[model samples]
Target: MAMKHFTIQDAATMYGVKEWGYGFFGINSKGHLEVYPTRDENLSCDIHEVVTHLHKKGIRTPVTLRFPQILATRVTELNEAFHKAMKEYDYEGDYQGVFPVKTNQIKEVVDHIVKAGYKYRYGLEAGSKAELMIALSMNLHAEALVTCNGYKDESFIRIALLALKAGRNVLITVEKMTELPLILKVAKELKVEPLLGLRMKLNAMGSGKWESSAGDHAKFGLNTQEILDTVDTLERRGLLDSVQELHYHIGSQITDIRKIKAAIKEATRVYAKLVKRGVPLKYLNVGGGLGVDYDGSRTTFHSSMNYTMEEYAADVVYTTKDICTQEQVPVPNLLSESGRAIVAYHQVLVVDVIGLIDTTHTKYRVELSGQEPQILKELAYTRDNISVKNFAEMYHDAITQKDELITLFNLGYLGLDDRAKGEILFWEVCRKLSRILSYKSLKYIPEEFQDLNKSLADKLIANFSLFQSMPDHWAIDQLFPVMPIHRLKEKPTLSATLCDITCDSDGKVEKFIDLKDVRDEIPLHEPKSGEPYYLAFFLVGAYQDTLAMRHNLFGSVNEAHVIVNEDEDFRIQQIVPAQTTDDVLKSVHYDPDELVEGPTRRRKISANSDANEALKTALTEQRKLHTYLEMN
Candidate 1:
């Protein structure tokens, strides 16, 4: 309400688009957000066009748009960053990267990453038997490597060995000492020597929420003594040549460069010592911790990364080379599992804001009659008298009088008409106080007044289940960039928090990404009636897809794979429809036909033939529809 001159530059800055876009997301001259797949403004596609195209094909909002070009570009950037770093550092070993399939096991996403990086000899990392199947099926280059991580059962080990015998470079990293004996036995039984690895528990700790992924008490990996004992056992068995990779993962979404440098140095020291001991280690697998700055603050915050891909690659290459040089050992071929950085920018979830819940009571006036209750009159006065000078005191007075009005109503002393008026007056007081303080504080608004914004702002009811789309936000408070995908040229005069269409109260997002701090409400344009106002949630490709829940029985959203053509135009490559209600019910072990049996029996017995026919059609359609709130 205070600022009249808002430019596209202001919108970009407000949303941190340029900071976190990584040259892939930006606003175009037409006031719509565009995807610059090639990092050139001339070669971009309007995201709104992608959504409209999908709409024309019978798909509605609450669809996940996948930019395969973005995924491909990220793969190239990561490998090229490491290559450039290795070149500058004069490192002897080659750089080969693997995308851990656990981040996003979607077929299209994985296929694109592999195809994009096939030239650079990129491969997939599997942590379980199912993912191992994905890796073996990948048309990976003959020289590309597939590294097996996580705890391995006999079945998991057998598949790795079979692949190795079939001429695929598969490295099985032993997380526990017991897994080593199984690997040795399985190799002996199959008569095919297994290329092995050791998941070392690093002495150094990474930074951010998952820092414990590498330290002494890490969930997996071998400790120092265990590593030595495994090496000794391999040496005694004459299998030293089979040990090919020494892998270590600090964590996922590492935020600090110092932690990465320290961890790499430690990992290389161990690799060099093993090489000196005649273990023939050739690959130093640095596990996936490359972070994507979802918030674009470039700080050490959990949601942000202080370092760039260039800096991360440089630190990794230089640190490894430096440590190897100190120990007089040749540098090992490098491999990284940076899954988050590779896939986070490749997907955007667009949900429609179907309705608005505004409680500001803009039409309410304090024209109370003389017969009104004393407390109601007091709240009306507070609403009328709030100002920049006396707003703080009037805010406190409004709170007191509003509470008394509620008490009077509960005690049967106040009528419904007067009670409703008092409720209107309380929210009006909040709105007036907020406007008065908006221009005064500039920076240091009191906490109470800052929270007043949420109380006065509208609650936009979006048509997607937060629990089904983004579980991390609810489970870990992770922030994803959320804003209107179109209408950037128009100044947003309304502010609101987003709520999904779930019955649970936790299925809402009040905290939003900001440059300076976490924002309580997002600046939004007023929604036009009968039109779907869409908001795109950015950087949700990593871990959100698989971690989503079926809370309230809401199924997955439709997925759109968007690829740019030769002239940098738009085209929908493929569409994956969401699970139908019947499908979801079957997943939960519910038989649709059985559930409809009683209704069908009742219809058959009834005399209203037309109504029964309508009921049958409705049941058929309802069973086939998606579980999300269908918007018109």
Candidate 2:
């Protein structure tokens, strides 16, 4: 049979790159995975070449690359989407997109977002005190908005009122009834009439793991009756006009558009009713749930979304206009806190495979002596006679004889040598069975028999900390796109899964993204000896950065930022090195000086020059170098 022909398109299709890349990425003629970050075809470079550039600077694999161009493009796309929607529908309400910094708290990310969004009066939404400080510090131009959310103490409320006093376009969203009295007192003390947003708990719950946190009983928002009571309280306090926005959050990463439409309809109706009652609301803040298609299924899958950005914008704008037109109230300005969708695509984590664990590499002939037990003889017979025609019965018999071998060993009927020989023969037989069952003539494959591929898939040991780099995968089983960064024109002859260089058994990735469902293994090319096999984990800019933990003391990885320029030119603008051993120790409150001295004093080495020089060199390198495994 002729070898199956493979092309770059074939590799792209196998990895579903086009399905989820959305024009920011593609395959080049040289079989390299190139990134066209600004959607400009001419301004592109393969990721492998970028990594090679870094490699020349002594930066090893397991690095992160941030494309500011992609980030800017996404912001522009979002703002333009809303603009087109408003123009097409002739909607009266204005649009301003507020990026919730809780999605990604990196300073460079937020700063680039501000610069990119300056045209649209784009703003930042803060969910904590520190994030609020970042929002205020980053967007002090007064045209950019600063939304203060989450539960507030006196200090939090006081800070928001102070921003209002500073002539900032800041809105302090009231999440609970108790927050109203607190906000009023803070405003009274500061003598500043605060711009407020009332967060209403709507009846529309989305479909996902976050469904439990949405709807009327959500942890953050107020009920309908409570909203009315708060409105009445504001009326009594002679501050009804202070309520400038009505906010509602369905959930984060909502998969279904029907739920979004329902939530928008409910939120618009609430805004309309409040407007009729003379609340003077100017902004209807429909909170974030815009999802990224991590799996590219584009269905109601929890990891994917069923709507496009334009569709989401149109639904929000038109639905609000339709509701308010019927209620005879003026349309309010729309603000969406779609943080996940905005920041999820700009960062890519690239890790190099350090080693491969092939189970069949140790395969050999296991000769059986005549004095061996019947179970061992049966296992040897199964191994030498296995084929596709009778693999099922042969596999079954091998399993049976293996179980009996274990029983014989436990019962002292088999010696150590006999048990070892039986174990080796059983695995050899199973390997042959797996190899033959994948033939072209095999029509029907049993489920258990098919699972042999997963069991036998090569293990690619990667050189990055899973807990530190991609925490969402470990915490909630979120799937990111994983594929080889180069060699796309060649066929992937190996089925493999990833294993991070952590001691914990859970530090591995066995499930991969698939069109129909989850896959157990990923197709990958065989790693060449003495060559770095690089793989990238894409779409990880959202919550993974801040949510990462210091599992096994792997603090952070090296990061480089790329800025694409006109005429197909790009430059590495900035590089942030990984944390050093001294830095990691200091972060955990361990003094590096004390640690070094303690080990040296405990060792009590001779006062010789050679011994002292060796210890000093080792200690100096340990304190200065990074925590990851050194390649040089």
Give the per-residue lDDT digits (tens) of candidate 1, residues 1-632.
Answer: 67567778888988889988878898877788888886767778888888988898899879999989888889989999999998998998999998899999999889998999999999999999999999999989888889999988999999999999989999898999999889989999999998988889998998998987678789999998998999999889888888889999889889999989989988888899888888898899988899989888999999999999999999999999889889999999998999999999989999998888866776566678878988888988888888877877888898888889999999999999989889998988888777777785655666777677877778889999999899999999999999888889988878889999989999999999987788889999989988778899999999999999999899999989888765547888999999888988998999888766657674446677687668777877889888887778
Model 2 Cα lDDT, one tens digit per residue, 253-367: 9999899999999888988888888889989999999888988889888888898988999998888899988989999999999998888889999998888886654445688
Which stretches of model 2 miss by more than 4 angstroms? 360-373, 387-389, 410-420, 436-443, 566-569, 603-613
Q: Which 10 consecutive residues of model 2 have the lowest summed lDDT?
A: 357-366
Q: Return the lDDT, model 2, position 142.
A: 57
True-structure lDDT of candidate 1: 0.88
lDDT of 1 at 168: 94
Once model 2 is optimally superposed onto the true structure by TM-score, how far is the C-alpha of residue 393 displaced, in angstroms?
2.7
Q: What is the C-alpha lDDT of each candidate?
A: 0.88, 0.88
